[model samples]
Target chain A: MNLGVDLTFLEFLASLPALVEWNDFTVGLVAFAVKFAILVGGLLQLPPLLVWIERRVPALMQRRRGPNRVGFFKWRLYGLMQSLADTIKLIFKEEVVPDGAHKVFYHLAPVFCVFPAFLVACAIPYGPDLLVFGHKIPLSVVRLDVGFLFILAISSLAVYGVSLAGWASNNKYSLMGSLRASAQMISYEIPLGMSLIPIVLIYGTLDLGKIVEAQTSLIHWGVFAAPFSFMIFLICMFAETNRAPFDLAEAEGELVAGFHTEYNSAKFAAFFLGEYVSMFVLSCLAATVFFGGWQVPFVPYETIVALAGSPNIAALAGIMMLLLKASFFMWVYIWVRWTLPRFRYDQLMSLGWKFMLPIGLANVVGTAVVLAVLRFK
Target chain B: MNPYIPVIIVLIFGVLLGSILSGLAAFLGPKKYLKEKMDPYECGVPKVTSGSEKMSVKFYLTAILFILFDIETVFLYLWARTFDQLGWLGVVEVAMFVLVLVVGYIYVLKRGALEWD
Candidate 1:
C-alpha cells in the first residue's frame, strides 16, 4: 500500500485494483492503449502481408509467377494487394457449420485460436524504448516481468482452439485430426520448454527485457551462448507451430486439411491467421533471445543513441533490426514449407521425445556447469 | 499504475477482435444449406463409421508422458533464473532433477509406449 516504495512483480500483481494515483493510472492506460494500437494492431495486419510473401516467395523459388494480377491501379505493388483481395473474398464467403457439429464450440474454437495469439504477440517487446519529454516508454503493449514464462504459458493455451475445432466439426477426420494436433502440440511442448531453460539459465533472468540487456554484447547473444539450445529451440519451434516437416497433424494429403477440415469462411481464416501470428510472435522471440531483441549487432544501444543524437531514432532502428531478423526467420518458415517433405507421424513424435528432449535436458545441465565454473574462475 | 492492467486490456481487445473476425462472415455472407452439403467430407462418399470413433491410444500415452515432463521442465525454470546466485549448488540440484527425468524417459522408451503402431 506504500506508494513511495518500490514493489516486486508479485507485489504489483497482488496489489492491483487497490492501486491509487488517478493521474498515473490514466497516463499508464493511455500509454497501453497507444502501444496496443501500434504493436498488436500491426500483428493483426501482419498475417495478410505474410500470406502475400508465402505465395510470392514460393512462386519465386519454384520459378513461377505468383498472383501478380491484383494491384491498386497500375502499380502492380509486387502482388501485395493479392492478400487484400483474398481477405475480402474470405470475409464475404459463406460460412458453414455443418450438421451434427456442436454449434457453440464450433463458433468458439477460432476465438480460442485468436485470443492467445494476440495476447502472446502483444507481450513481445518490439524495440528498446521511446523517450519523449524525458519520459520513458517501453515499446511492447504489455510488459510482464516474467515475459518469457508468460509467453510459454499462454501459447500452450492455443492448442485448445485446434483441438476444439477438430472435435466440434463432428466428423471422423475432424476427431482424429484434432486428437493428432493436440497430442503433437503437447508432445512438442516438452522439448520447447526444455530448449528454453538454457536461455533463462545463461541469462539468469526471466524478464525478456533483461535477457536482451544481457545479450547487448554480440558475443553474449543467445544463439552463441547456447547454440545447442537454439538448435533444439529451432526444431521445437517448427513442431510447436505446426510448420512443415513437423506438420503431421494437418498433413493435407493425409488428414484432409487436418483439424480445420470443417471450418469455413472467416472461421477457417481465423485458424490460418492464428497460425501465422504465432509464427511471427515466435520468430520475434527467437530474434530477441538469440539475435538480441532490439540491440544492433556490434553497435550497442548507447552507441546507436549517441550516433543518432536521439534515443527515439535509435529505438526505431532497433525495432527495424528486430523486425528484419524476425522476417528472415519468417522467410525461412515459408522456404522450409516449400522445400522440405513432411515428417512421418512416428518420426515427428520420436524426434521430440527420443532426441530433442534429452538433448535439451543435457544442454541445461551443461550450461549450468559452465556458468558455475566461469563464476568460480 | 499497476502493470497488470494491460493484461486485462489485452484480453478484452483480443476477445473482441476474435469474435468480430469469427462472426463477420455470418452476417456478411449468404447461407443456403442442403442435406448433402451439411454432411461431413468423407471423400464425397457416405459415412462408413460414426464420427468421433475411438482413436489410437498412442496419443493418450504421449499426453500422459508430456504432463510429467512438462511439470519437471517448469520446475527447472525457477532454478534457471536464479542460477547465478545459486551457482554450483543450483547446478548440482538441477542435474539430479534432470537425471531422474532422463531415467524415466528411458523407461518410457523401453516400454514401447510411444510407438504409434
Candidate 2:
C-alpha cells in the first residue's frame, strides 16, 4: 500500500531503532534505566508488603489473628506470605469485564493511578551523592529544576484513575463514588498546595535536595520553621490520599467498595498497588519536606560522613534516615486508618475547604510576614 | 542528557507494565460469562435502572474553587521562590494582594458557597 508523502521521514523512523553509541548520553540513559528499574522494582515490591502491614496492623488493633495461618508448610513466616498468597489468587481469579463498561478507559484507569506514583518517585532525593565508581552520582533518578511542583503536578493526576474507574464501570455506586472521590481529592488539594508555599518560602527553592541540605539542624527543620504548614500538610495528605478518616471515596458502608467495585482480577490488584504506592509517595514527601528529607538530627552532614567512614556509607545512612522518617509517617497512615472513623461527605468537604484551607492560607501569610521581619531586622 | 528522556521512559514503562499485567490477567484468569454475572452489582437485586444520573452541583463548585485557589498557589510559588530578594516591599504588596482576595474569600464564606448541604 503506497501511502502519501515523506518516504525519507519513514526511513529515519525505521532507522531510529538502530541508533546506538557508548557516548555520555547513552551511558546516562543506561544509568537511568538501571536506577528507574531499581526504584520502580523496589516500589513494586512495596504494595504487597504494605498490604501485609495494613492487614496485620488492623488485626493487631482489633485483637484478632489476621492471616497468621498463611504459613509455608508448617514454617509459618508469621503471616508474611498472606499478601503474596492473596496476590497470586487475585492474578489467577476470573477476570471480569462487566457488560456496558468502557473497555478502553476501564483498563486505562489503573495506568493513571500507578504512573504518577512511579514518576514522582524520580524526584524524591533518596540521599546525598554517592561515589558510585568514583563518578559522584546523585542518589536520585531525575533532577528536574521544578522538583516539588513536578511532584504535585504528577501525583495530582492520581485522581484521574479513581474518577475514571468510577465513570467507566457504568455502575451507580461507582459513578457517585468517583464524583465524591474526585471532589474530595480536589478539596484537600487547596490546603496541600497552600502548605507547600511555606516550605518553598522558608527554603526559597523548589529542589528537594536543597531543602534537605537547608534543614541541617533539628530546630531548622521545616516542622519547626512552619509548624502550622506541617500540620496542614499532614491533614491534607491523609485526605488527599483517601486514607481513612477521609476515605469517603471507598467508604464500604455507603459505596460498596466505591470506585473499584466493578474491577476484578489484576485490574483490582493494580488499584490496590496504586493506592499503597501513593500512600508511600505522600509519606515520603511529608518526611522529606517537613521532617528533614535525609538529615540526621543533631549530627552534621560532614560529621555523618566522618562517622560512617566514607561518603558512600554516609549516603547509605541518609537513605536509611529518609526511609526511617518516611516509615514513621507510613505507620501514622496505618494508625490513623484504624483509629479514626471515616469522615462524613459534608464533614470532609467542610474540613478541607472551610477549616484547612483558611488555616493553610494564614500559615503561609504568617510565615512570609515573620520571615520578612526577621530578615529585615 | 535530556531529563525528560528518563521521564518519558518511565511513562512508556508504566503503559507497558499496565497493559502487560492486564493482558496477563486476561490470559491467565478463568472465564465464564453469564448475564447475571456480567450485570453491574446492585445488592443481588434485578437491574432496575442504568448506572448514571445527574450529580450534585457542589462538585462543580468545588472544582471551580479549586481552579481559582490552584492558580493563586502557582503565583504564590513564584513569590515564595524569590521571597528573600522581595523583602519588606514584597511582603506588603503580597499582603495587599491577599487582602483583596480575602474579601472574595469572605464573600464565598458568607454566601455559603462552601456549605455542603
Candidate 3:
C-alpha cells in the first residue's frame, strides 16, 4: 500500500517528452472533435429511446402492451425501432410558438437545458487511451481540476431553464411545476454535496480519474466503508434526477405536463432529452465515486492484463464495465419512475431537509472519527 | 499530454463558436414582429404583472448558508493534507476552527434564521 504521490503531472510530461509533447495537442484536438460529434448524435437519439423506455417499462409493470405497432418489422422486435421512427416523424412537424410567448427566451431555454448534460458527458471516461495516427489519447474529452463542482454547478443551472419555461408559458400548471422543480432541486442539492464530502475526505482528491484509481481494492470502494453516505447519495441522486417518489414537479394529475406544458415540437423534446441524459450523468457520477469505477474487482490489474489481455485491452474492458454499471442504473431509473407514485411537496421537503441532511452529516463525522481512531491503533 | 494547451484551445473555441452560432441563428431565423405575437405574455396572461410577487426567502437563505458552510470545508481539506506536518497542534487548530464555525451556526439557528415562515 505505497500511497505517496509518485510523479507530478509536470514531472511525467518532462520524463516522456515524445508522449506528452506539443504534437500530442493535435491528438487531443482530434479526440475532442470526435467526442463532440458522438455527444451531439447521442443527444439527438436519447429522448426517443427514453420515451420508449418509459412506455415499455410502465406497461410491463401494469401488464399492458407498449409501442408494439410502430416499426416496419412489427411483433418480432416489439417495435424496438419505434423511438427512431418517432424521432424522424417529429423533425418535420411544425414548431408551435404561442401568441404571447417571449420568443427569444422560448428559443434559448432548450439550448440551455441540453448543453449541461453534453458538457458533463465529456468528463466521463469511455474507453482506454485510444490511438490515432500513432499517438495515444485519453478517452475522456477534458480533465478539469474542479470536475465534480463543475458538474454540480452546471446541473443546477438547468433549473433556470425550467423556471423560465414556466414563467414564459403563461399557464398556472406550468408555473406551479417549474416552481416545484426549483425548490426540490435546491433542497436536495445540499444533502447530495454533503454526502460526497466523505468520499472526497477518503480519497483526498476531487479528480474523478484519481478517485477511480484509489478504489483499486474491493474494500476501498466508498460504499462499503461509508455505507450511510452511500445511501444518502443514492437517495439524493434519485431526487436530483427527478425520478419517481420525488417527481412531484411533473406529477401529471396536478400539473398537466408540468414545466414543458406550453412547449411543442423540438422545444418539448429538448426537455425530455435533458432529463434522461442527466439521469445517465448522475448514475455515472455515483458509479465512479462510490463503486470501484473502472478498476476490476477482486483481480489485480497487472496479473489480469498479463495473463489474458494486453494493457490497452484491459483498460478498455474496465471502461466498458463502468459503462455497463451506469447503464444498469439508468434502467433502474426507468424502473423506479414507473414503480412509485410522486411524493407530496411537504413530504419531499421533510425527507430531504429532516432525514437526509442530518444523516449525511452524521455519516461524515462517523467516517472521520473511525479513520482517526484507526490511524492511532 | 500537454494539458494546458488543450484546455486553452477548448476555452477559446467554445466562446468563439457559441457566439458565432447564436448570432447566425438570430440572423437566419424569420423575424415577424406583430403586436399580438411580439408582446410579452403567456397563455393569454399579460406579462406586466406575472410571477409571484414574493417568493420564499427561506429557500434563498438556505442555499446561501449551504454554500458558505460548504466552502469552509475547503480549509479542513487543506489541514487534512498537511496533518502530519502540523502534528497535534495542527489538529487542535482545526478543531478550534470547526468549533467556532459550529458556534456561529448555532447562533444563526437560535435566531431562527433557518426557520421557514
Candidate 4:
C-alpha cells in the first residue's frame, strides 16, 4: 500500500553493501557463490538426463529397446550412461567445415545458440527464499521486477543462432531449416506472450517470484484463474520450443536434420544441448507461471515449516516440489513428441496466426471485462 | 552482492563454457579434410545448384509481421502491469487497442500474408 516507499529486489540488493558489516559481506559473498554454483550446475546437468529420458521414453512407447548398451559392468541402468558416451564421442570426433562456408558466422552460431539458454535460466527461481544467519536470501540468481519481459527479450535472441547457422552453413537444407525455425519462433511468440498477459493482469506484477508467492495455494494458481490462457500458453510453448506437432523446423522427412545439418563435433553438440536446455527452461517457466512454483498444492508454507520444524528442510522441500513439477512438464514434452505427428509447414503457420493469436486476444479481453465487472460490484 | 551480479556471472560462465567446449573439439579432433567431405551434404549425391540463393518473400513478410505484433504485446505487458491502479479506464483503452490490432490481423489473414505455397 505504501507506493512511495516500495523498493524493488534490485534496489534492496543494491542497498546491501551499505547496510551490512564487513563480516556480513563475506557471508553474503560466500552464499552468493554457493547459490550460483548450485543453479548453474543443476541447469547444465539436466539436459543430458533429458536426452536419456527423450530416448528411453519414446523407445518404451514404440516397444523398442533404446540405448541399452552403455554403462559400467553388467548393470546398464537402462542405458542412462548413453548420454555420457555420446558426449565423449562428440568431444573427440572430427569437425567438418563445409567448403565455401562463411567461417566466422558458422563458428559463432553454436555459441550464440547455447548462451541464451543459460542466460534465461539465470532469472528462473528454483526455490523459496532461505533464511541464513537471519538474512533472507532469495533462491534465484536475479530478481528483476520486469523478470518476465526480460525472459521474453533474452529468448528472442536465440533465433539469431538458428538463422545464422542456416545462412552461414552454405547448405540448402540448413537454410530452409533455419528460415522455418525463425518463422515458427517469431509467429508463436505472439500467442506465447499474449497468453502470459492475462496472468500479469490478474497478478498485476511481472516479477516471477512475486507471481509464485501470490499463488500460495492450488486455488490461487494461474492455471485455475485463467484456464484458457494456460492452454494457449502450453500450446504456444510447444511451438516456441519447436517440439513435436510444431517441429517443422527440423522435419526429418524433408529438411534432413534441420538447421544443424552441416554442424559437427562439439559445435553440433552445442546446438543439440541448447535445444534441450531451452526445453528445460521453458518447462520451468511453465511451472513457475501456471503451477504453484515451489509451493506444494494444498499445503501452505506454515504447514511445511511446522512439519519440518526447520526452514532449511522446508526450503529443500520447496526446491524438490518445483523440480518435480518442472520434470513432469519435461516428460510431457517427450510424451507429446512421440505421441503426435509433426504439423505441415502451412498448418503450423495457420495454427499460430489464425487459432492461437485470436484466442489469446479474446482471452485477454475476457479477463479484463471480468475483472472490471468484479471491481464495480 | 547486487542481484544482477549473479546474472553477469552466469552470462560469463555460459560464454566460457561454450567457447571452451568448441575450442577443445577443434584442437583435439582429427583433421583430415577431404574435398568430397567438405562439400554440402545432399543424401551423399553430387550437388545440383548453389545453396546461397535469395529466399522466398514469405519469410520477410513473417519477420515484418512479427515486429508489428511484438510491439503490440509490449504495450499489453505494460498495461497489464499497471491495470489495477489504472482501473476500468485502462481496460477500455486496452480493449480498443487490441480491437484495432485484431482488425489488422484480419486484414493480414484476408490478404494471405500468412499463406505458404
Q: For all the predictions, what are the DockQ values?
A: 0.73, 0.67, 0.19, 0.69
Point out where model 2 deviates above 4 Å.
A1-27
CAPRI verdict on model 2?
Answer: medium
Instruction: DockQ for candidate 4, please give it.
Output: 0.69
| Rank list by DockQ | 1, 4, 2, 3
**Poorest lDDT segment (10 consecutive residues) of candidate 3 chain A:** A87-96
**Runs in model 1 lying further than 4 Å from the true structure:** A1-23
Docking quality tier of candidate 4? medium
Which has the greatest DockQ?
A: 1
After TM-score superposition, the amount by which residue B69's alpha carbon in candidate 4 deviates from its true location, in angstroms, is: 0.3
Global lDDT scores for all candidate models = 0.86, 0.86, 0.69, 0.88
Candidate 3: clashing residue pairs, number: 0
A280: Cα error in model 4, Å = 0.7
Candidate 4 TM-score, C-alpha based: 0.94
Every candidate's CA RMSD:
7.5, 6.8, 9.1, 8.0
Off by over 4 Å in 3: A1-22, A73-76, A127-136, B1-117
Error of model 3, residue A377, in angstroms = 7.5
lDDT of prediction 4: 0.88
- TM-score winner between candidates 1 and 3: 1
Expressed as tens digits, the lDDT of each residue in A1-377 for candidate 3 is 34596987788677884764457666567677777667556655666777887888888888999888776643447767888776555444455566656767766766666666666766765544555567776666777666666666667777777778876776566777777777778778877877877776677676777777788888998788778878888888888867787988788887777778777555566666677788888888888888877777787566767875566777777777788877778888888777777777877876776677667656665666566655543
Candidate 2 structure, TM-score to reference: 0.93
Candidate 3's TM-score? 0.81
Q: Clashing residue pairs, candidate 1?
A: A288-A293
Better of 2 and 3 by lDDT: 2
Q: Considering only N, C-alpha and C atoms within 3 Å, which residue pairs clash in candidate 2?
A: none
